[model samples]
Target: MHPKTSSALRKVDAISKLLIHTQRLLDGPYRSKLSVSTDLESSLSSCKDQLDYLLRKLEVDFTQQPNGKGRRRDKLLRPFKISSHDLKWPFTKTEAEDIIRRLITAQELINRALQVDQINVVLSVEQKANLEKLPVANGAIFNSFEDEGEPECLPGTRTDLLRDLNTWIADPKETRIFWLCGMAGTGKSTISKALARKLS
Candidate 1:
């Protein structure tokens, strides 16, 4: 197999695995979180189905190629880019060609629907707004009257504590809890506020 073709196949395998895992998560705890209504589940399921179909189609297309050195192999391994022009269908139409076309559409849908970023899982506009309206830390509200405009952390102070906390965080099998202790006026709350800001 050509090197590029091998690389493309590997990527397809990785993406297929990720899609399957995402599908499972959707079926699991995230089902209610991701859903807009009953239809959101169906849409996510459809995306997973399309991704599976695309992966299979990609495998068949690559395998059917003779030695993976021909135009088909090159086409399959080509890098995707957004172009203003519409893609041209192959002159010689076949069932495989039709499958390939559908695969492209499926891949596009999956990309748009499943692309998650730093903002947790992918959410629709309405979902995002609803989530924002939710109180922080499970409805625990903090009054900002005195706490407003507080510094995220006390700069240049609590260096030792911060270092120890960072070490704890980086420890592979570390316990999940960290206890901070200090005398009454020793700025424990400030340290906590700083730590929360840094962590968040």
Candidate 2:
């Protein structure tokens, strides 16, 4: 698995655990007793902050759909007034229900993100294994031969080209195959390896 993705998964897992803890506090027998507990307030605040951070970091745009229908989806959580006192404790039953509802929604989103990441990791591992079974011809395959030095573009070179390739790879609308055609020794392999490393 990619190091960055692993780190993200850990963070998301932590957030999910925090949400669960908070939900249990609200549902437990000591709920009324801990209504004004500083710990409870802090936990709720942390949950809100972490959830917002993850949503932004993941770029999980609630307005967009995979089908390009341009229709907006329901928000993960309703907008709350931006004040520290906005999350006051001693929550009413209705307020507690609303909070639980939002927490469930956030958990659902987190689960979906985890599923997507797991799918990508599995696909990546399977693809690499399949590639390993293929024959290597003069190091034609990327990282196929350990003795042969891997081809990669030199640092500070092909900056514009790399940026364009990255943009094309990111844009869902630009799904066509990008052909990096050049002369035999014109560093096409190098550029390809560099792009692959960047994506990885």
Candidate 3:
């Protein structure tokens, strides 16, 4: 097997284990527990963190629009919001079940993608051509040959601005366009390039 496929399979296995563990947690005696236990919270937190990491490793972007027979994949990649309080004991059973269902769906999608070969799994040739026609700003991306001399926020500089932008990106409620307006030579382009690199 190719190295990428092997790595993806391992991630899928990890996701499967997490799903099973969560289901068992909900099915076990803890399901009826009312007290908030540190152990339960830790377990839940670890599970969620692992799931997020695994999804990232698999390059599963919930933000991307799925096409063609990707309706199922789209459903599998549906984003969910969870706060720290959600990880506390006496957790919502329905929410836990929903998470398990989503994990299972994601696992299935990954398996199917691996089976069919990864290249162009989500786009057809015509769709690719259409996307190719979209205009992209030259040198707008960080580390491009055209912007090789460009610096990215000088390590630790613009920390607050970067944080705010990331928070805005993660927020589903803030659906408005994020206009990064600033005077020329004030580093607006630098910040944009940094953000683009971070997301990439």
Q: Give the TM-score of candidate 2.
A: 0.34
Off by over 4 Å in 2: 1-138, 144-152
RMSD in order of candidates: 16.4, 21.3, 23.6
User: What does candidate 3's lDDT look like per residue over 130-165, in tens digits?
Assistant: 879989866464576787877668898999999999
Model 1 over residues 1-200: C-alpha lDDT tens digits? 43433554565565566556656766786666544322344544665576566555444433333554555545654566422123322123465455445545655555554444213343456568987896676322233566666554556877998889888978958886788887896777777767666776
Count the clashes in each prediction.
0, 0, 0
Point out the worst 10-residue segment of candidate 1 by lDDT: 82-91
Clashes of 2: 0
Q: Write the per-residue lDDT of candidate 2 for residues 1-200, one digit (tens) a residue.
A: 22333445466566678566656765687455443332345545656775565545444322334453332232323354232222223334474445445666656554554455456667768879987997756646555666257656778999999999999988969967788899899988789888877876
Report lDDT per candidate: 0.55, 0.59, 0.58
The Cα error of candidate 1 at residue 71, in Å, is 31
TM-score of 3: 0.34
